[model samples]
Target: MTFQAGGSFDIDAWDADKPYDERDGTKLTRVSVRKTFHGDLVGTSTTELITVESSAGPVAYVGIEHVQGILHGREGTFVLQHSAGSEDGTPGTQWLRWLIVPTSGTGELAGIRGVGQITVTEDGAHTWTLEYSLD
Candidate 1:
């Protein structure tokens, strides 16, 4: 099934982290993602690349890396550490977020234990979404 959704995110490195100005220029972002799933048990994960363009500026592409755990009963969870920096994308803008989600074991996951530095965006707002993808 093909899907389309709109969302936003908030990034706060830390109350007292390095690069103070970076902490201030910090802005919330909204994005939309679409993917196609291939049917297969013990399905393989396809790489997802995202780039966001807001009315305020240029396109900001996200460079993400994920390490997923094993699948249990056609469902599994993956822990991902995403950093928003790439010489091939936006410059002077960086971010980091962690994600945990239920695996369709095929495509994009929903009903997530969305934590770390990431949140789901909807109707131009952001919120944490979690449902525990594993036991």
Candidate 2:
């Protein structure tokens, strides 16, 4: 079975630093983010991301996100793996995939698997939709 969860989140904290420039003209940067969610689910999440920037534009990034909170009254914790990219800086040109780590769910959310998408509006509001299931 599958269920849908929709919500908006606020970035409680964000810190990004440009670490070092690689020899291949790719600049690598590290970013840490924290968020608080509201709507069908209420919780907090922390993410560690490594962004790769190429000469053409923003290239790709991979990150691990740890989320703790309640989803539809079920409390638990889980991890999401992030792999996403943008070919160019064009509007609506970015894509992202967030996958729930196998067997990473805890509490009532144990055995959860899902995929989610996030959209940031032009005004900077962040919204998310998650299609998931729990066994």
Candidate 3:
């Protein structure tokens, strides 16, 4: 739960939520900032369309990302928080997924790199908050 930034982070009540299974579940969160180098970051990504193998996987979920608003030398990437789990209100009792990876390239970022974390809550949603710095 530590980011690669040069300082310590104390995120205060940054709330985020999504609808699932005909209900809205509330979640608790915390973040450790790794980088805060300034610049506007703009990019897109795609998830690997996963299918339920057993009685696992989410019933439903949505992606609400926070793209890093920083860059350096016209190069940067993002860490997509591909978090998923069973929409059944029970956590640690099921298989939850936390996939963290760097964003693909284009434009000012031809071959940039970044790293971040993805957190999954038992209430039926997840969060992805990452930072990007020059390589």
Candidate 4:
């Protein structure tokens, strides 16, 4: 059966390295982030990201996040592959999506498969929604 989950998350830590590559007015950097999930999902996550920034500000990022916690009432862990980007560095022009890594679920989350998205509110709050199923 498929299930839906929604919640907000707090960014506990964000450590970004100085630009490792810069050319044509664009910069690339590596960032490590930690977050605590709340609401329907309860747990913490660590994410590693490669981000690209232009003179217009953040343009894109790709990341892998390992989340360990309880979803709804099941306790386990899973991985999310993130792909996000903005055409003009505007919230309204961005797309932030998550793909559950196949076979990456553990414990009660085993066999989970789904896709999700992240929304950043104007006030800078981060919220998320997931549509998934477990075998």
Candidate 5:
């Protein structure tokens, strides 16, 4: 059966490298981030991302996040594949998505699979929604 989870998370840390590649007006960099979740899903996660930026602002990013803790009451771990982008570097034009890595669930989370999305509020708060199922 499918379950829905929703929550907000706080960014605990963010470490980014100087642009490793720059050309014209675009640049690429690597970033590592840590977050703590609250609400229906309670956990901590570490993410590694590759980002693209332009004069307008952030253009896109792809990442992998490993999360550990509890979802509802099920305790375990899972990995999320992220793909986010903006056509105009504006919130109205951006999309932040996550795909639960197949077979990456451990412990009580085994066989979990689904997709999720993240929303960044204008004031910079981050919230998420997930739809998933476990075998």
Candidate 6:
């Protein structure tokens, strides 16, 4: 059966650094993220976000997040892969999407498969909805 987990998260820490200049005023930046989640899913996640930036704006980014926590009382861990892009920073133009890595689930969540979506409001309120099923 499929289940839904809804929750909010707070960015506990974000460490970013520019390691090199690719060219044309574009730089390669690496960021480490630590977040704490609340509500239906409870625990913390550590993620690495790599962003490609130019003089205009951020061209693209890819992130891999390891989520460790309890979902609806099941204790386990999983991974989420994030990919997104946007240069103009226009509303409805920039997109961020995350998906579960196949067979990455462990513990009680072994064999879990699903997709998740995240939304961040202007006030920095982050929310997530995960639709998933467990084997």
What are the RMSD figures for all models against the true structure?
12.9, 1.5, 10.1, 0.5, 0.6, 1.6
The runs of at least 3 residues in candidate 1 whose Cα sits more than 4 Å from the true structure, single-residue gaps closed, are 1-45, 52-59, 62-93, 101-112, 117-135
Error of 2 at 51 (Å): 0.6
Off by over 4 Å in 3: 1-45, 56-90, 93-103
Candidate 4 residue pairs in clash (backbone atoms < 3 Å): none
Candidate 1 residues 67-131, lDDT tens each?
A: 33222333443544343433333333434354543342232333434334433333423332222
Q: lDDT per residue, candidate 4, 1-135, as tens digits?
A: 999999999999999999999999999999999999998899999999999999999999999999999998999999999999999999999999999999999999999999999999999999999999999
Ranking the candidates on TM-score from highest down gives 4, 5, 2, 6, 3, 1
Give each model's whole-structure lDDT: 0.34, 0.88, 0.37, 0.98, 0.96, 0.87
What's the number of clashes in each of the models? 3, 0, 4, 0, 0, 0
Of the candidates shown, which would achieve the greatest lDDT relative to the real structure? 4
Q: Give per-residue lDDT, candidate 2, residue 87.
A: 84
- Listed in order, each prediction's TM-score against the native is 0.24, 0.91, 0.34, 0.99, 0.98, 0.89
Q: Please list the residue runs of candidate 2 whose C-alpha ends up more than 4 Å from where it truly belongs after superposition.
A: none
Better of 3 and 6 by TM-score: 6
Model 6 agreement with the true structure over 66-119: per-residue lDDT tens digits: 999999999999999998777565434667778999999999988989988777
Off by over 4 Å in 4: none
Q: Residue by residue across 56-135, what tens digits does model 5's lDDT show?
A: 89999999999999998999999999999999899999899999999999998989999999999999899999999999
**Clashing pairs in model 1?**
7-121, 8-121, 112-130
Candidate 1 to native Cα RMSD, angstroms: 12.9
The local distance difference test score of model 4 is 0.98
The digit string of per-residue lDDT tens for model 2 on 1-135 reads 999999999999989896666767788989999999998879999999998888877778899999999998999999999988878743378777789898999999999999997777888798888899999
Determine the backbone clash count of candidate 2.
0
The 10-residue segment with the lowest total lDDT in model 6: 86-95
